[model samples]
Target: MASTTLRLPGLGWALLSLLLAALFSSCCLASASPVMNGPPTTWLSAPVPAEDTAQLRVFLPSPEARDQFLWRLAGAGVSADLTTLGFCSSRCVDLLVPEVDRQAVEAALPADAVLRTAERNLGGRLRAERDRLAGDAHRTDFSGVTRASDFFEDFRTYAQIEAFMDSLLAAYPEALSGFVSGRTFEGRPIRSMVLSVGGNSTVVDAGRRSIHLQAGQHAREWLSPPTLLYILSGFLEETSGSANLPLRDLLSQFDIYITPVVNVDGYLHTWKGDRLWRKNRRVNSGSNFLGVDLNRNWGPNSTWCTEGSSTFPGSDVYCGTEAFSEPETQAMSQLLDSLPNVALAIDYHTYGPMILYPLQHTYDPAEGDDAAHFDHLATVMADAIRAVHGQEYEPMPGSQLYPHSGGLIDYAYYTRRIPAFTVELRGDGFIVPPSNILESGEENYRGLIDILPLL
Candidate 1:
């Protein structure tokens, strides 16, 4: 038997060839494209090349020494990103420096100033970790009622958070109250919730002193909102008779106001576009960078463009043109002003397990009269937190953490004269693994419970 040969028409053959060429081109492009999961791509495209950078944990005896070294680094035209702030003299700061200038940085340091390698190939590591976490997040099931695990399993997107909030309100209508405080710069509503026995009716109770709790001021701290949600969940349980009587008694006396995510625009950006976007999405005039660190935009004692903040738009700690320039900050400040009595306030952040009080602008305590009281409160809260996870959370003045000019805790205490504190939750930096969420939530809840009596 002889096999017959097949032939196609000229036009058909040309079309087939074109299709094959297109397929080959597509594959080539896919292979050539860089992997883009992880920290904001904008960060990698910063002035210094990310591949040639190394993250160093510099240990110094004092904050002054660290500042002096940083000044020297800046003078040498070396770019350094401050990743973590500490409270004591022997504080270790994580700084990303170009590999080319690593030797110069080491040489510029004093004899006692030691540098330890934290991360090499910073962009690559961040991308790999992000991709891994994203993959794990895809495996989560969000079908029925969200369990305690669901909130802590992985970082939720903005839509997921909104959905969770809706479910929460629907589940416990009497114990939780929800509202829109104000709109963000990007037109997103800044949602808030009140935990009280009467829910919505709590607003009418003029005698009730309110306690405000806020998180997500910096968008990259994905763990902040969930931790607050965890605390909220405990409050709900107390109202439902599942928790202890003491908790119920404490919760009933005051309305607990919680803003889960303050930087709504930036939080969305972290979920959809970049995993490490930190500031609110506010466009700056004549600058390619777009955002202002909400934490640095508060007023009444705002030392803008000073230490712990930057005037340059590209800097991570970029303070806005003026105090309360960002709409998110404006909305929050207004809310605080409108409340008849805000006895206690807490601004939650992440990456450092510390409880910080006022006077962030300077090392000196501005509220000298209330200094002892603040310390006692912080100590009690810290002890409560440590009981759960055995994690030692340093309780100190915010200024000891770093020389931050404008901060929420400072504004709340100084301008409003309300007792406020900043709780910096600890994990693997900003991106805490889902496994640690529940423990963090539980520990923080214990701390809050201890704090209520004082409030």
Candidate 2:
């Protein structure tokens, strides 16, 4: 824990880490190129009005195409966001390009790169998505959850989300205990609910292992909170009614900790300010940027701001001024340290049907995380998810998706020695349809419970 705290390394260690990285992390050289610091990874924040932006799903033919596109973007001075919390693949990524620059971005790409506009008007899509998710949020019988299908029919505001948790707490007092993890940058309480058959202390007294499921590190991924809430509702249900035997067994023996939203300020901002906001509400000193990307503000790892993140305050993937610079991440890391025994940690995200495991900052295999065991668990989880709705979820290392430094999963895995993972939910646009929330949660519930017996 001492070594893993949110403190920068001394010059000696920092240089040593680089040397060792140069020696063995060659596999991730392309991804780890500090691309974010320069104009290549920077999308220049787009030139057009923010609301006029459109999303492009670019299919790169090869690594060369990807590189050329980045350089082309830089040379053309065209803004093409290739990756971020944005969905990415071995040769494909989704980008948000300005309406005027679409043709320029398209021309910058190689002939082989297949670029398709995912959303014609990102702002209009979000506005409509908000309206749709706001449907029938008020119900006559909203006193308490009579059945597991009580809520999640629509997206909820921060207040509504908290109210939903309170309802669950009141309904299952014996099984649920609510606590404030900490305050966010905006002074909002970051809350969590622990689910155990008898209660939290009982789980501790029994020496039960805990698995934490959290979502909403990025603000605009609106489906994440409710999806996680869906999972929470499923697990906290009476075991007698659940045909999910593994979940029953899990509840009988393990503690389930659920945090529906980690970036409270960002989420609140999404509701009140920009519907597409991505970072926490932190006004950087001497800069116009008003937030720091919480996902990239984690850890003091060797890869801190090297790749997959930016030093610029305006960048979407900005890593903050330093590791754990934001209160949200500090709160999250505090929560991680408070857990007596964490068997696994999974941070959920939106717009991807993928299960990602750690050693995320590098392409190298983890020395002690038992790659085979991790693979097996991820494989089974993916299968279970697919079985539910005939939708596929690829299980792979996060680095293979894209090198992300200072990521929460990397911090949880490399520092705490916990088996950490990230699940990207439903690879649709961030403005996911409301109807899909319950179904995605159900499928993910299957994926999660399937691995409990094995854990």
Candidate 3:
């Protein structure tokens, strides 16, 4: 064999190349941990050292106690992938915590306390950054609407949002068509809107191509419901005598149904008390226990309390005592199942800037290419969003994100066969600057337009 050797680049060029590579890698890593810029919607946990342990979990007295603990812990230096469990008391804290953090964190806690710990999941760093940003609440310039739209003023209370919805209906009697689907356990209305293209047809009776969109499914994902409301305003506001032209066109092709603030009670809680509250305000059976994670309340009976959920009613990912126990989730479930033609569905959340497709409630992969419908659509939509607003997002299967079972996206796809996606929006935090709200929504709004046309 002839002796041959490749020459190295010049010192300067080599250094430059290394620097660029490092910068790119840094950007990618940062992207992986989407930043939060508002208040948290759930409680924090105990503090831990970074890059020290592979996993960490804390023993929470109850789900609510866990929330408060996690919030405080996040404020401290510790973060971990959460696996909310029901039966963890002081004695069994070791069962959940990573072997490394178990002894240290447990020693720091009360002797008789239960345990909370991290699973072998990689969500800790991301959760910390997101939570940090979420805690940075501020005000920003209003840039959501092009023309002079007055909807952007003070942060709307639950009462204000309802008043706005009511006004829309009253102002455009014929234009408004929809249902107050059901009430939250706390008696809050789960309002849904219908922009009927063919005038007077029930959404459940809609055809196979009918489109479904929802926002504010996770009460603490603050960017979602407001963006939805803004989009609704755009649809109703007649610009140049063609106000809803684009939206009207969309409605003509498919029945447009939007539900903002599905978890009305939780949404209100975010506004009123804790900005990080994730569960619905449903009173648990005994004691002063309160709330259930409505998002995890949709598992089929057979798959309840699997992964991606907690059996504890107080955990943020808590699956309810039973599937569909929350009236809000139940109402949506009935409506989705009744509508044979729900070709597409979106359950919007924020603080990740990722588009998540189905198969959440189960680890079983799809049987065929049919499952690719959501995956492909999500990519297209995310790309479209980036192009319009210069925002970036990742599109991936729901399982890749957290691998939870009994999620809304899973039920929509596996059970109903509707191509659904759960969109995780991002910002500093849930109480994000009012100014950023419109811009964030605009980016997503454009993305929605891109995907809606294809559907």
What is the overall TM-score of model 3 with all chains considered together? 0.67
Best by TM-score: 2
Model 2, 117-155: lDDT tens digits are 787787677667667656654443454652355566667
In model 3, the Cα lDDT at residue 437 comes to 67
Worst 10 residues of 1 by lDDT: 36-45
- Residue 147 alpha-carbon offset, candidate 3, angstroms: 7.2
lDDT of each: 0.69, 0.69, 0.57
lDDT of 2 at 422: 87
Per-residue lDDT tens digits of candidate 3, residues 370-453?
Answer: 567677788888888888667777787766544566677778776767678887775533445667667766777777777776
Better-scoring candidate (lDDT), 1 or 2? 2
Across residues 1-455, which tens digit of lDDT does each residue of candidate 1 receive? Answer: 11011222222222232233225433212212342111111111122225555667788877667755654454443333322222223255666566666776787687998787766666665566567667544432454333454656667877777777887888887778789998899999999988776435435467778888999998878889988988887677656754567666777778888999999998887766355677888888876667888887888643543445555455566677888888999988888877767899899988678888877766778565787788889999999999998988888888776667668888888767777888989763554457677888889999988978886
Count of backbone clashes for each model?
A: 0, 2, 59
- 10 residues in a row with least lDDT, candidate 3: 1-10
Clashes of 3: 59
The parts of candidate 3 lying over 4 Å away from their true place are 1-148, 201-208, 238-247
Which segments of model 1 are wrong by more than 4 Å?
1-53, 79-90, 135-147, 198-202, 301-307
